[model samples]
Target: MMASCVFSRWKIPYLASMYFRGVMRIPSKESFLCSRVMIPDIECSSSKTMWGFKQYHDGRPRGPLWRGKKLIGKEALFVVLGMKRFKDEEEKLQKFIKSHVLRLLKMDMIAVLTELERQEEVSLAVMMFKVMQKQDWYKPDVYLYKDLIISLARSKKMDEVMQLWESMRKENLFPDSQTYTEVIRGFLKYGSPADAMNIYEDMKNSPDPPEELPFRILLKGLLPFPLLRNKVKQDFEELFPDQNIYDPPEEIFGLR
Candidate 1:
């Protein structure tokens, strides 16, 4: 017999070997006009034969953050998002700018700043926020300001937080319900119940009436003072009769 020879369209015959363990052939599955592709290489050692891949080099890295010696990737993104802790806010901010994290798209940058806030890296988050403010293409975004406000509020930087709130208004950008909620929460955190109530009043007067959660949250946040909590408690009860409302513990209201 012909040893069952395999042939291509051009009558190309395979090299038949009785000791052939596995099939082998040149990979032509992927080919481009001018692109590097994974081409397999045959390695034959003293004891065995194996197939390996030759490294594919596509000239150079591509993207905004890709460069000669200062290429940065996911690791840099992690550091920018506060996954890799820094000694101080300035250090983190410097790394963020140096890593070219801001070179990413605006939507991506917003997410990163939000992540920074979630990680409680407020100081650096604030600095990066100012950098964003100075950008010519920067548009007013409620969530961006909200994240920074919450971060600053937690850090007890209420002065700057309110300043941002006022600036948001002057730009004709209104705070959504969730934004109002966070700002109120931040005010409560910083022991500024008066300012918190002012924002709450604004929330109540907003063109769009806020949901019950903000009312409940601000009500709970008013535990330190009996007068305010009682007033909101009634309004909260009136708003959501079917839904159960949780009141702060009596002790929080100075009851034994």
Candidate 2:
């Protein structure tokens, strides 16, 4: 039975190709020569399979090539919009870029979505966050949130940065040392040193803060205050007696 089936399958393509050639012969000579050449179904199938295999071997899926192309197009649109230098036009451009990013993410093109993010397009970033929040994709433990927080802080959007931090906390995502440091730095820059100190103290008291957390937090928090600087250093020594202190000479203090 198997041999008979294989023989029948092999004959089918040959019969179909012969039938197609026969039909072509009835056409006028000029028309026949000018008409599209019909390749055998077997050949067409073989070519398609070969192309698919090549794509697969090259680490690309055979389904869609539009994802990368779409990302490039979106990037170009962002650039064109950026050049306008008008607030209303820039806002519109940002909205368009964000919409495209959301569409790509919905289609599960995570790589392209991530690339759009890496471009540091602030409008896109804000829109992405809105989409993430809407879709519940923004997890506190995810490093992306930390990155977004830092970006927002750097952009001097302190309100948004604080809101993101609150959202992270509400999601029960404990901030890492790096996130804490970024927030501390942001607070310091914004004339909220007390807030920075609060974050520093919280980090120092964490159960498993990073090894450098105490020293880094103390030094950063106290560096601007002369009297508190030595006190903070001494406090660090008391807390971690084995740690070394990089104190400047007393002569540098003009005490010589």
**Per-model CA lDDT versus the true structure:** 0.66, 0.58
- Per-residue accuracy of model 2 over 1-256 as CA lDDT, tens digit each: 9999999999999999877864443444333433455633212221123322411122233433344555555544443334233335767756654565455443343333344455555445655556656664544444767777877767667778877777776776666777777777777678776666666666665666455664566565556665656665766777778877775665665535
Worst 10-residue lDDT window, candidate 2: 51-60
* lDDT per residue as tens, model 1, 1-256: 3544433422543334322434453333233412253333422121233453444434444643243123334644564645235535666646657566556666556655655676677776776677678777898887788778867766778888888889888877778887787778878877888898899888877788668867877777777787888877787778677778766578856865
Clashes of each: 0, 0
Candidate 1: 10-residue stretch with minimal lDDT? 40-49
lDDT of model 2, residue 142: 47
